[model samples]
Target: MTSININKEKFGQLIHKEKPVLVDFWAPWCGYCRRIGTAYEKISEEYSDILIAGKVNIDEEPQ
Candidate 1:
C-alpha cells in the first residue's frame, strides 16, 4: 500500500485506528528523509495488511 499523506486533520483519527500505525515525520528539503521515503514505501506495501503507513510533511504542516 502507498503511504498516506497525513496532516493535523487526519492525525488524530489515524493514531486511534485499530491497526498498528507507522508515522514518518519528514521534510521535503531533507535529502536523508527523501532517501528513506522510498524504503518506507516499499515496506509499507509488504506489510500493508498489518500496518497503516502514514507520512507527515513538516515543511507544509508544521506543528
Candidate 2:
C-alpha cells in the first residue's frame, strides 16, 4: 500500500485511529528527508497490513 498524503486538517484524525500510524513530518527541500523517502515508502508498503503510514510536507503547511 502507498503512504497517504496527510494534510493538516486530517493529521489529528489519522493519529487517533485504532491501527497505529507512522508519520513522517518532512520538508521537500531537506536532503536527508528526501534521501530516506523512498525507503520509508517501501517500509510503509511492507507493513501496511499492520499499520498505517502517512507523510506531511511541512513546506506546504507551515503554520
Which candidate's TM-score is highest? 1
- Angstrom error of the Cα, residue 4, model 1: value is 0.4
Candidate 1 per-residue lDDT, tens place, 1-63, comes to 799999998988988888888989999899999999889999889999999999999988898
- TM-scores of the models, in the order given: 0.92, 0.88
Each candidate's root-mean-square deviation in Å? 0.8, 1.1
> Model 2, range 1-63, lDDT digits (tens) per residue?
989998988888887888898989999789999999999999999999989999989888775
Error of 2 at 33 (Å): 0.7
Give candidate 2's TM-score. 0.88
Highest lDDT against the true fold, candidate: 1
